[model samples]
Target: MTVSPATASAPLARTPLDRRVEPDLRVALCAAICVGLALLWWVRGGWIFPLDDAYITLHNARVLIEGHDPNYGVPALVGASSLIHLSLVTAFSLVLPGEAAAYLVAGIGPVLFLAGLLTLAQRLSLPWPEGIALALAGLASGTGQFLNGLETGLVMAAVTWTLVLALDRPSRLLALICGLLPFLRPELGLLSLILMTRQTWSRLAAGSDRAAALRAVAADAALALAAASPWLLWNLAATGALLPRTMAAKQAFFGHPPGSLPASVVYAAAMTAGGIGPAAAALLFLGRDGPGPALLWFVSLFILGFALTNREVLAHNGYRYTFALLPIALFAVMRLGAARGPSVLRLLILAQWAVALAVAVAAPTEIAAQQERVAQYRAVAHWAQANLPQARLLIHDAGVIATASDLPLTDLVGLKSPDSIADHRRWTAPSNGAERFRALDAIARRSGVTHAIILDDAPDHFWASLADDLRRGGWSLDPIETGSARGPYILYRLAPPTDPAAK
Candidate 1:
């Protein structure tokens, strides 16, 4: 009934569990739930992920398993958003089939994610039930994102447990994990950067033993970087950039300043809902105690960065970027003792599971719809793979195509082709559709692109009125062959090689 501000490091000793419960028992519940959900998904979708991007990683894993060069046209076609996720799936594929390996790594993340909550509960000495509630509430806030094949469960597990470790005390282990953040997911690296920035500021402001504090900061920062050095060095060596081509691709295709009031509110509101507290709670608990200040710092700055960088302003991307703020909020409200784990938590937990269940029921159908489009494109892709073996296919999205056929691809959005980043920009430019199509058609012709396909149903922000654009641009469309996959796809023949040998 009372709100008390305390430091994030303060002990949550108000109500310890009266009965002892084995940690493994809590862990087993998490593992069981994860398996059950995966089974439900597999039964319906047959290993097709709700997100096509999952297949990108799956395809790359198979490439590694076969000992083929992972890179395609470019040496830096790292091909996955998470190097860590790709590496884990590749390792799992050594013993299991490629699809099953992807499935296993996928399941481990949520298991570790929920298990880490129990670990947090034990460290806080809270009752076991509260731990499960926090975990479920987490699922609710980002239910759809976790199953997205972005290695979300893993990213969350690392972030949540890292927060847990940071709360306990600083250690070499914590430094190692903090350094590994970017490999988990690039957005997560922001968490470490923000937390360290807070630590550096606090120490400097204290005005005592300044040299000692600076040395400590430098050493910890070095350790964190050292832990991440391999992935960092490899990216730099291969791509000549610190971040992957994905960043460049995103910047070109969907990057926009977060200037719109409505878009900003929707983005902030989603964070507020996920954190399960009013947005103002961030200001209240910040700098009061615990990781609350640092986490709030991370979320705010991340939102700022995203607003400046993204055109897709909704909270969850098909490639999920949100993580850990829920735990941070839960920790904040609980440590502050605000409303003492409100009764509303029960309703919220039920709602989250309901969403997860709903996703399980609906995701298969959604995947089927995507597959219909994938099949539409696949006809062109398969023919190129067999008939014109040396030619590369250019397409809008790269995930399913990467796995479905052996055809090499130049990603229209540039995930696999950094050189096309400008083309991606032109394709998604705010310009009229006909103008956009002419610009792209010219580029494709010059690049010797013939087997090019694009989705007619992409978001308007990406491109608009494609059928009109093609007609206006003096272009004719080739309909895909008859099948279940026949849909609104346009194949443009930009100078198909006449002689079979010319291709």
Candidate 2:
């Protein structure tokens, strides 16, 4: 049997990565990393993340903890983009309160991600300095999401370990985990395919057991399908779709075509290029010797998938969708071992790490300030809870408000509300006020919404514009009158149509 060059990177049939280091010490190091990052963000900033989306994830955890159907005050819809994180936080919250549980789970993401990078670096035997820099760069790139209390870190953790297993372990267990990747986040599902392809190919290239490798790949695929079956079936049964609506909602919101490449090309490129860390991660792939081209392939496919799906807004929410690419790039670096490229490559790598570290260090205060701004939104939610306890509320600024109050909610952004969830494409399309008006009006009427609580930046123009067409004359303005925040919002008493004859 002849071994191809591709087999050169294959792991020895032994446990690797810090294998020489004591297990207890490794665990201690991971814990310290998790705790250190958590304090660096939360103690300096605040308990909550700066973004409203974090609270949306938190809300799902709370609902699960309370044993309610996972809905944002409606049935047949799960509000969170990541059910995996939701379930994890819910499980964690059973031992701790929802907020603390969420915080702990969130912190675990970066730690797992860092540990993964270090493990891979050790397995591949990269220089210690480069390994640490690469690991920190990956962590820093996603610091916002890790600290924000969302599933970005979990997604990274999952991807890292999946890669680790695929490259080093290569078993049926890995394939099964890959199968559940989409439920974690849609991008990971794509990664699952790419990884399995590489893994299967690598085994074939080994020339040791062609028949056994083929059988193993088949078994892995079957296990993955088995792992993923429940989610797909449940979604199809409940929502008439095989995939979650969250992706569709976001694509629509950003005016990304659900099926296209031409229109999305520039946007997707901009999204990919927007972050120095993610870009540098891909760059690391260029000047290294590797048996396979997994990272490059995945990144290309990711951008292509984004274009076809029209999911730009890459720079949104701390580049949440793109952050996974950072750790993945580092993983590629580990697989390829240290770069033997020009000195410029090393300097550029160091520069990427420095920028990422600076952003992460400064993020706490910035995030805290942003949360302070959201205080008004929370205040408004509290006001509605106290004053209009029975208000069937239609709300913008969905996240913090949903967590802050129990006033029945119909997310004005259509992320949660049953009436509005599928209407994102219709409303978000490049259309005039009338089209968006009919969309929102239908949601308001369908939900039997008596009042609306819309909070936006300063004048609250975006939400206000969406509500403009409704016959909402003399609606209450600034109902709560809280301190300076992102915005002071309006709670409207949506009037019945002024013209009785006009339907």
Candidate 3:
């Protein structure tokens, strides 16, 4: 009676032999190789950020850590591109100096990005081989942007993790991520909105009771709104605007002459396909089921947003805006191959992995190119900090130099200066160089600007007219002697009008 099978505890269910085998070995190997490639690329480049925008965040982080609002040492505006990103960088800066923080952030970005990729691959139920390929594609697609120290990698990780969690089930954590999305990057809010709406609608359609579905939707909405409220309130209070001044300036710059929308969209799509490697071609034919629709919507909306705002800017930014779409594209491709057969999927993965390996091999050249481009600004920043430390300079590319020099800067581009934004808004005409120069001059005088720094190769009409106006206005223009192959940046020194008539 005591030995009765029902009364006796059954032997614990034996763990499946397959389950005991490490599933992540190949994934881990791929991540190590890719991350090593990224680190190698950074080391070759001397661990410098590849973009000037990164320095802007560094500067702001330093400001925040030093017990000031993240601004260019002037009026407190929400000038940092992402408050959350700035906060993280500021935290790192507290532990390390500004430059060291930048490098540390850059190195950490790929790790977070790869972790998110692996999590997504697991959530998608992809086999380890396919997961390796996905990791490769992600590393190849995102390495440059990650190294550049933009919000690209952080946004990528957030977007991938959010999508993975949302696809599994509704949770408060997912809602929280949705709420915090905009603080990562304003455009990323589109992903949050799309995903939340889709999830809520799916629940409503599937639920037996309409009221229950409505409650769930309301809960999700409330969580998202609550999480997002801080940034919204802060921006409103600090800047009297919901969006950053950068958004307004970008809209003003890129929203015009709205080149053929279809053409812009097509061009962006082509560029994205090329950047994501051979796997992107497979995304075109993937079924709408699985992660395809979410990915398609994300990529389509991004391209459409670029078309409406500034396709040229997207193209010029090394196709960085599209890098966020890479993981999704790779996921779609993996899913397509898996649906066909494991063998087919494995072959596709191999092909994509080979492409990624090529990208890794070529990374050194890309790093060199980026280093050369960034060197000019860095050198000029050092020069200005040393020689013209006291000059109140009006600058076009204000991020690197202003941060580096600790200069009192009036950003003619409007990113750091509310007054510059006001001037930009006041002048609605197409970029007339002389008129633009006059507006800048007005802002300069108002800000007590005694010197100016302008990129000689700047495509804006303002650059075209700068030298002429400098001479006519009793400002002497001298090209800064940075031996950069990119070109010379001009530095102008203001002198009191020699001619009484000019005054």
Residue 60 lDDT in candidate 3: 72
- How do the residues 1-503 of candidate 2 rate in per-residue lDDT, one tens digit apiece? 11112222543333344454424444666888867866764765536567787787777667655656422644333556666777788788788766787778888888888788777655555544665666767777776678677888888888777766755656777778888898888677777887778667766777687798788778877888898998788667756677777776655554644434665765776676565364344434533334246666777778777777755557777667877676666655454443333243356557667778878897877887777766666777787778777777777667787788777777756677645755655765554233566566666666777777665544536555655645442222334443334354666676655553333
Clash totals in order: 5, 0, 0
Q: Give the candidate number with the greatest lDDT.
A: 3
Model 2 alpha-carbon drift over 4 Å, by segment:
1-29, 37-46, 69-77, 202-211, 257-263, 276-291, 332-345, 430-434, 458-464, 467-486, 500-503
**Candidate 3: tens digits of C-alpha lDDT, residues 208-254:** 99999899899999999999998888778877887566766754533
TM-score (all chains, Cα) for each model: 0.80, 0.84, 0.83
lDDT of each: 0.60, 0.65, 0.66
TM-score ranking, high to low:
2, 3, 1
Strongest candidate by TM-score: 2
Q: Write the per-residue lDDT of candidate 1 for residues 118-159, one digit (tens) a residue.
A: 666555544456546656655555555555566777877887
Clashing pairs in 1: 7-289, 7-290, 8-289, 8-290, 9-290
- The local lDDT score (0 to 100) that residue 125 gets in candidate 2 is 52
| Two-way lDDT contest, 1 vs 3, winner | 3
